[model samples]
Target: MKKPLIDMKNIRKTYANGSLEVEVLKGISLTIDQGEFVSIIGSSGSGKSTLMNIIGCLDTCSLGEYLLDSKDINSYTEKELAIVRNEKIGFIFQKFNLLAKLNCYENVELPLIYRCMETQERRERVLKSLEMVGLSDRLKHRPSEMSGGQQQRVAIARALACAPPLILADEPTGNLDSKSSNEIMNILIDLNRKGVTLVLITHDNDIAELAHRIIRISDGEITSSIDCKRGM
Candidate 1:
């Protein structure tokens, strides 16, 4: 049998603000299969973002186990976690995190450059990723020259350039117009159909409906997990 893509058991996260200890995640557990499309929905401060950070290898749990691609997350050092992040996960943030000065192609090619990919291969990957996002024609345009939607597309292309197995999108449509939001969601749906496991983090119910499974969280705990794909 194929192994699960993500496994978290009894996960907990806490923050220390001076003498106060704040428990953010309270024994959360979840499993995501390869090729699955799952959404984590929560209001602000529901620990949804905290969960996303752990799953993306950007943060470690204070307690419990997290196995990503069958490797123990606790075993990876900070440097190893950085490598794991680049190799296994693609992240899309609410804010289009593209640098203002870099052109679309340059932004998309950044990860490849960090990986030390050859010039020719980097060019091909960047072109292909931009094409996937329908921004091939905007390759030379800087982020400042593009609309919010266009800038977000560039961000998506940057995420795709590395071809990571899991795509973690945190409110990818938060800053877009309705038309642009739909376009972005459609692109994400297409990516899911093409076999990239997706985990979307959103507070919008309509947006969460797009996923096959919707896991709702409140007060740092899972309130509900609905499988929407059951009849489909």
Candidate 2:
């Protein structure tokens, strides 16, 4: 059988300041298969955000093993971790972290530039990703020139530009209104259907319910996990 896309075991995260130590993730063991849509749901002050950071390779776990794509991520050096982040995981943020000065196409092409892809290849990828997000016509427009939903779509395109196997979204709809949030969620659903493994962090149960599986966390521990019908 093929290995699971994500295989985390007893993952822990702790922060220390002076004489105080706070444990954020207390032994999280979860596995997600390729092409699955999983949502991590938690309230403010919970460890979902920290967990997302760990999964996205932006942070390391304090203890236990994390296997992303069957490789031990905790064993990697800082530079290797950075490379893993760029090559294996795609990130979408709540704030739509786009460059205000760059156009949509440019923003989408930034990852390819890091890979040193050829100009023609980057152009093809950028245009294809934007088209997937339904932003083909807005390629030349800047983030400041678009609405919140459009900006989020551009962010999605940027994430897709790398064609990573795993997509990690942290409160991707937090800054959007209801209509915009649904639109963004629909786009994510479409991507998952197309074989991208999706992991989303959200505080809203309604939003979490949209995913095929929901993992609930509370007080730095996994409280429950449920499989949904995925009415997509």
Candidate 3:
């Protein structure tokens, strides 16, 4: 049997509210297979973002067993988790998260630099990922020089440069117009077609339906996990 890329069992997250305690996740359990495209959908205050944070190793669940790539995530130290985040997960944020000072090429190459990749190899990856996003022509342009769509493309290129096993996209089209949203979705669909594992977090049902599987979350719990590939 092929082991799942992500496995979570009875995951929970709680936050302290001064004298009170609040639970954000209520014993959530899920799995994502390699090369699968899954969308997690929910409205605001649904704890969807918190779930994404745990999945990306950005935050730890208060209680649960999470095996990422067959390793126990809860057992890993913070530094080890940082390494895992860098090598195994690519993140696309709604805000783009590009540095104000860096140009396109520099921004895309940042992760590779953290990995201490050789100069020539870093050059190849930056160019290839930028080309994938149609941003190779804007290598020298800074974030201020581009529109929201273009900046999002640059962010996508940054995520791709690492060639990570999983991509975590959080409302990637939230900042874009209709045409730009479609274009970004097309790019993501193409990436999935080429065997990239993707987990998209969105509140829009229309966008969620685009994935191979749809998991609807509500009030810190998953209401449904549907295989929606047939609808495509």
Q: Which ranges in model 3 have alpha carbons more than 4 Å from their true place?
A: 230-232
Instruction: Find the 10 residues in a row with the least total lDDT in model 2.
Output: 223-232
The TM-score, computed over Cα atoms with residue i paired to residue i, of candidate 1 is 0.97
TM-scores vs. true structure, each candidate: 0.97, 0.96, 0.97
lDDT winner among the candidates? 3
Report the Cα lDDT for candidate 1. 0.92
Q: For residues 1-232, could you state the per-residue lDDT of candidate 2 as single tens digits?
A: 5458999999999999889998999999999999999999888888889998999999999999999988999989999998998888999999999999999899999988998999999999999999988999998999989999999999999889899999999989999999999999999999999999999998888989988899999988899989988833
- Tell me the number of clashing residue pairs for each predicted model: 0, 0, 0
Residue 161 CA displacement from its true place in model 3, Å = 0.5
Shift of residue 106 alpha carbon in model 2, Å: 0.9
Compare candidates 2 and 3 on lDDT and give the better one: 3
List lDDT for all candidates, in order. 0.92, 0.92, 0.94
Q: What local lDDT does model 2 show for residue 202?
A: 88
Identify the runs in model 2 with alpha carbons over 4 angstroms from their true place. Answer: none
RMSD of each: 1.1, 1.4, 1.2
**Tens digit of per-residue lDDT, candidate 1, span 78-188:** 999999888889999999899988999999999999999999999999999999999989989999899999999998899999999999999999999999999999999
Q: Candidate 3 clashing pairs?
A: none
Candidate 1 lDDT at 232 equals 54
Model 3 lDDT tens row, 109-162: 999999999999999999999999898789999999999999999999999999
